[model samples]
Target: MDEMPFCVHDVLNRPLFQRAIVLAGAQGIYREVRWVHILEIIHAAPYVSKHDLILTTGLWLKRSAKSGLEYMRQIIEHQTAGLCIEFGTTVDEIPDQIIDLCDSYDFPLILFRQPVRFEEITQDIHAHIINQHFGLLKKLEQFSQQQQQLILQSTDIPAILRLLQSYSEHQILYLSRIEANTYFPPLPEEMREAINTFCNQQMKHSDQIQEMELWKMDEHRYVLIQPVVCFGQVFSYVGMLLHQAHPTEYMKLLVDYTSKAVATVLLRTQFLEEKILSNQNELIQDILNRSIDSEEQAQMRMGLPSPNGEKYIFVGGIIEFEHNVIEAGPERMESRNQDVLVLIRSLLKRDRMHHVLMMKNNQIYLLCAKARIGKDSESSLYHKIQGLIDGLNKYINQAWPHFHFHIGFGKSRTMLLDAWMSFKEAFQVIELSQTVPAMKQNHYYASIGVYQLLHAVPYPILSDFVQDQLGDLIAYENKHHLHLIDTLAMYFKCMGSKGETAKRLFIHRQTLYNRLDKISDILGEDYFQPQRRHCLEMAMLGYPLIESYHADQ
Candidate 1:
């Protein structure tokens, strides 16, 4: 429970109010009281704020000829704490209708049969109200200090939430999208799932939301949802249920302080986890840099299984990021990395793949190991890894499109020490992905077919090779704005089937024939001969890679 509110019940127990008689609306004696307001004006509802205790001699009602019931009605409409009337001095008398109205609305009405000094009453009550607020502030300060000490001593989320529960005395909920969800006082499993599903839908529909608000969970429940922010990102939310009561101002303050404490705990825990990950990544980096020389040294450095009975084949892979599309600060990038890291781990676990994943600056690397199953072991793992990347692309594109990236895999190695060779092959695959859009679908280095042979050739030689066969045709097509090259390439792709080429190009056969004639005149009819056909086909394949590379620059 929040600090017990100073209510009308407390005020009635004061020495000065001891002689006051309880009229109707006695059941509302617990209404919260903030301060005392003495008003003798008509339309007093606009002058007095909510939770104020009104002290008056009924002067407005007597002078303005307003009904006693109407005056009390205005007090109730303003939501004042209660009404205390000095009965005899202002020619006043209590009306049954006024008492009935107060009773119906649960608005408190207190009567003083004798004349009383209004100034003394205001002074006595105002001091108590101010002192109560000061006491609450001091208590909140102490709670904050204790929370910090507990966080410093241990990065335990549940313990901190439990402490908040002790003060708020409400059901606590900590929901996280990147981490595990935690709740206090225990919740049903189905209820947890329902809440998670609802939250996911809300986030997908619109993630932009206020930091703290009263969210209605169902028809009967409302919760004060406070997003726990760490390093400028909200990865999780922590809230306290409001039961059936509306949250008070001080209660809102309590929730804010507690959320800050939770954020501190999350950041601290992430800091510690990051330290461990950094050390592990250092080992992976050393391997990539070829600093580790021996199999035993590599295994020990990464804490991998020793040279025992089960032989593990190691392969390297990379998820290379595109830098041109994003402009984010280091902190925002780190937060994005954390989110991607969690999703990647979940994928690895689902595939039951043993791996050591490393997150470097612009790329994520995974050194995976599987039991050797004859010569097909590597091939089997290659397909599985391909499927994993495909799944991730499909899932993350819909969920986190900004995480767009290219993927590449290397050949499997028998020894852990040879992991560096795998990484080198992965770099080769990444190079191909940048130049050849077709290579994006073929993640494995072996799947590049003829490109693997061309990879050995120098870049200048490859460019010269393509130009020597197709340079005149390229210039002719560019100058005339013709589709001769496309028609010819599709003809090659369709294996000289003019009908299929025309259909694929969405053109008539006559149009394709005309383009092909132009292509023949620029190059020569002998270009389709066995030797020249081979050269022309190779040039067609290399032309796209060169074109895409230049476009990227």
Candidate 2:
């Protein structure tokens, strides 16, 4: 602290100024002395300034005791550091009235035991003050170097705070607005409450306040707050609390410097995090798009476990964010995304799962190693993939209950080269489920049944196939306003049971038989043969897609 050099008590502790004794104002002994000034006239108070330690021979005050009292008041009014009265010249001894005035004002009054040259006193005190300033500057330089080293070594905030606390010798509390928590050296319950309350009130006023300020929480404690600002916004605050009601100017300076260092660390950390996230997203996109030419290249880019001919299952999940929720604001979406990422990463790490997770086009994709734990079962991969999906969904729902989110998993692939197919399968399952009402949550490729195969077939091929098999009946039904196609489908569904087909169609047996006779005339008698019937049934299974395609045409 520069305090020792600029203090009246420390000045007296020096050998050259040791002859000085306090006549009154003992309570003000610790007043800081900024400069030493010689005062020979009674009207010198006008020229005095704060922290100026006055040296005098009491030449004017001896002429009138009443003026001595007035001079003390003037000294106190100007907030001078202290008054030193030389006892050997002009005045024999200090006046009782002057002493009382000094005590009342809490002003420091010193009695010089012997004759002391004003030039000598000023020279010595000013030299000490300069040395004190130089020492503080040196210390500040060292602190800057140390902080730079610490930042380069690690980006841990707690470690940084611990170092800063040692240098400051004061209790420190770091409140992160981004993390929504207080960190660093722990605080007492009462102290934490007081700081939290103060922060809340300040945020209510303006969250962008970046300046340092002091608050006297009580007679024994004072808090200094220095905000960590980035891009004209305050993201956190570093607060210092001391037992003294008023801390030294030097201590305040240290606090400001530490807060600035904290801000630098935060900005650097954020930049690195963003850079890493971007790289991860790019790698994930490359993998899912089949742009990654080789598994070796993937391992090099992500430092992930090498596939090395190992199998992996690609699980893609999409949150069809409600338009209203998205329209609400970007902040809400950003918060939710962060929560999801954190949860997924945590779960992945906890389970020691070899996985890659990233966000692409507002959807999250996960790729996990498909290594079997023991004897592989039909449902082992399903259970594994389902567990990850359920865990992520549960956490997300817990965090944001008002929002609706659905998750889907895909089939496992035996080769890394087929990862892109797995990703597409998972994505398609999600799209199909949401598009088709019959699809359920947690939908997967296997659960999609024949619809999966129908989707794989091109719309033109499926339409041509449908036309080749059922074109005549479809044309007849369209021309006559009769549902021969429906009747045929029901007949096929009921395995050609006349009574069952009629019952399912809500028609009489006579009506079904008549429709079947017309269908036979359009398709020929050979249509009901085993091979032709199989082809017709296959086309029937894909009829919906084929019909939709023809309608669009």
Candidate 3:
């Protein structure tokens, strides 16, 4: 959809101005000319726009010697395309000062030795501009029609993208969560990976569609990043790589239409897949809802491919999109959940993971089974699950920056009917993710450590326990604005080594001794006795809970 750029050189090529001679500033003949205008005002800066070719018989310059120089300065400063002068009637020959000024600025100056009609020149150049624009619009219409036909012919996402390469004549990069990423006409593996990394970067403001530079391209080129959004969520991206200096309105329209066409194909494909998988989906629902007590029935309902008498090892996990998603509103939240369901299924399918996925209470709940021991090992299964969470979390968080993820994987179970225990463990893991930073790295219940013991305790008792153990020390620090509690923690961290504790606290050993003495007076020296010291350490681990309790108060 590119139209030829009309410039001063093209205008002078016309037969109407055949006798025109270049008087000065011949170097800027290539300057663009969008329209032709007659200069009637002395201060023409306000009326003249860039790309305008000013035409005159030099009457304005004949007003006074000073007026001539001033008028030319306004034309150059306003960046008008050029000036055409007719050496007859009002003014005969031009002043040398004006010609020299035009030459210095490289402002194109043309002169007609014979009288020429300004009307003919304006109409002739204007007709060419109008014709080129009309052709561009017609080409855009044809491209749109072809894409619509491609959608009807096949539901393949790549089929839609192929049109982008053929028509727009640029390398096309289509990144989809639902489909394998494609490079139409294909790029080298390394370049494609580099471009993929470049495109996947999170934009500070994702809603603004713009051009991006392609890394490692020998020639200067750009990639127009256009997102494919459906149901208010972006699930894929379609980008065009070319040498355009900036994103043209034509390029924007082309990418926009192409993205929508791809979206339509993806939506239809998803609908058909959902229809085929509806029964299996219901089986997963029944397992999570505890409506089905028999693993045999679940196997039969989902049509499991496992051999006769073979028991499947099942693992359950919950991927929690924090409670704040509810603030986005109920209907919108529902749509968002459905979109996530699509994303998770796509990701699981991409990793060849055996999973039954669902969105409940704005969180993702899935049960994956190991049907083949050699094909998908336990470690491989965990790797796949972690990859699924990381990929989905990265993608969705980019679209909704405020959204965060907390994931928990349950212990593997021997039967689908007992899979609910695994799910519960996963929920505990999700809870741990909020209070335990170590839990961020450890997603399983087996690695939860002491948090498993504290998980079932009520919030009031936990907070009360922390305060009871450290109450006097906390009170002292608050009253004196001192970090005696920090000193105490560091002292414990250094294992009763006075010098190490002082070094860690950035205080002298005597200062550490003074703080320890104050603690000795406040809580009694037996606070470091084996049994009492253990309680104080656990209280320190639970310190944030009490801090949160105080904040809420």
Candidate 4:
């Protein structure tokens, strides 16, 4: 039911003239003879369609010699398949101008002897066009089969690059991060400068400028740059610098496939690591509960050998009210460790007196100096611990904003089991202090012993009472522009020092005092009074308990 397709070559190859024999009636030179029109002919121009088998004689030729040539030039410009000139017409000779135009334009110009009928060539011309279409379809099918196989069998990145190079005729290809960094391999000086400028400007303005390409780098090379985003983070970039004049449609398809494959590989690897880590975390917790010979023996069982006689335990946790803001995948966690570990180690190194330190999960354990009872060294050690925690908090606040950190430190213990007990107590205090209003803003509360008797009390009784007292203030602070609740919390943390709180908040001293006075007036309590400050601090610490109870209800 489909119509026949047309081809320029098939039309050119059509036999327009019949061979003449004196004896018999003229024999047909081909199975059919069809009329061919030249679009340049004045009368024929209007009737010509895009792919018409145009037919014409030189009837429109003018007296001037230049006219014949200009006529042929016009016909060629129209992209006609071929021109047929009848020798028996008013123009007995084919003009040189016509011949020259046909040659220059690479157009077919066929000559017909007298008495050739154009109608005979139509059927045979249509049949030839159909055959060419079948041939093209077969080639496309073979190519598709080959490409599918290539995609399935390939694993090596270089091998895939080579395959793409051979297929696309492009020489250069590379993967880069969306977050361009100094550690990346150097680029051409000019290109490097441009990219650096672009990155710096983009950081100041917006993060939306994701990817770009450098075109016209050289006559022989074409470039493509694409952004790679993994797990909702812009991770890297994949670039291709091809030594080809231009890219083809197939090359684009290959690039898309390769990018997706790389993402899949990265995702799978992260999942595997997390699966292993989760198992190990459970195993470590089990070991902690069991009675181990010594902390050194525990380390050995955990595949970590202790180097010195001392040990310390640090417990920390990330608090996120909304889990979606936090990235839980293993790859994200590992990436975060790059900056966090540096901060932790830097803090530990600043106190060079501490002998050994080890990081386990969110907690850091250190084997620090021991104090004799008479030396009053416990107070000094407490100060050092407070300083370390404060430094960590400051670093984390600037580097990561969405999450808050809670740190718990335990004193050094001789036995591994004793260290485990200290770590457990510290972790429990961290949990309990979240419920108690009085201890909330206090960084280190030494009143609670290594046993967590406070944590056993139901949080609701304390939480509800505090919430009832502070509910309106909390709601108003959360609703309006000013952050009164955080201000109160920070004020208590700085030991009611207005200047210190102002410095921490990056506000003027007078501004902090004004806000504190306003808070005092609204709550009908003096801001400077120790009793009021203690009550507010306790209320803030008990917020987590209030939140938990509300959630359960």
**Top model by TM-score, which number?**
1
lDDT of 3: 0.78
TM-score of each model, in listed order: 0.73, 0.51, 0.68, 0.37
* lDDT, residue 418, candidate 3: 78
Q: Roughly what TM-score does model 2 have, to 2 decimal places?
A: 0.51
Clash tally for model 1 = 0
Each model's backbone clash number: 0, 0, 0, 24
Per-residue lDDT of candidate 1, residues 252-314 (tens digit): 787888788888887777777677777768877888787876777677665565554337788
lDDT of 4 at 417: 47
Question: What tens digits encode model 2's per-residue C-alpha lDDT throughout 1-553?
Answer: 2223357788788777777788999888888898999987877667899999999899878668987777777878888999888977777877788888888877888888788888888898889888877887887788778877887888776776777677776677777543444645776779678778876776566545668877676777666778877645466788777665556667777777777777788778767766776887787788767787777566556544544554344344444444245464777676666656655665665555656667654567776654544556326656656666678666556545767655666676655556677777877677665555557464677788877887899878888898899887778777996788778878888887999999888998999889999988998898778899988877876776665555656
Which of the predicted structures, 2 or 4, would earn the higher TM-score when compared with the native? 2
Best to worst by TM-score, what's the order? 1, 3, 2, 4
lDDT of 4 at 534: 62
Off by over 4 Å in 1: 2-32, 41-47, 65-146, 205-210, 249-254, 273-281, 303-315, 319-415, 439-450, 457-472, 495-500, 522-536, 546-553
Residue 499 lDDT in candidate 4 = 85
* Clash list (residue pairs), candidate 3: none
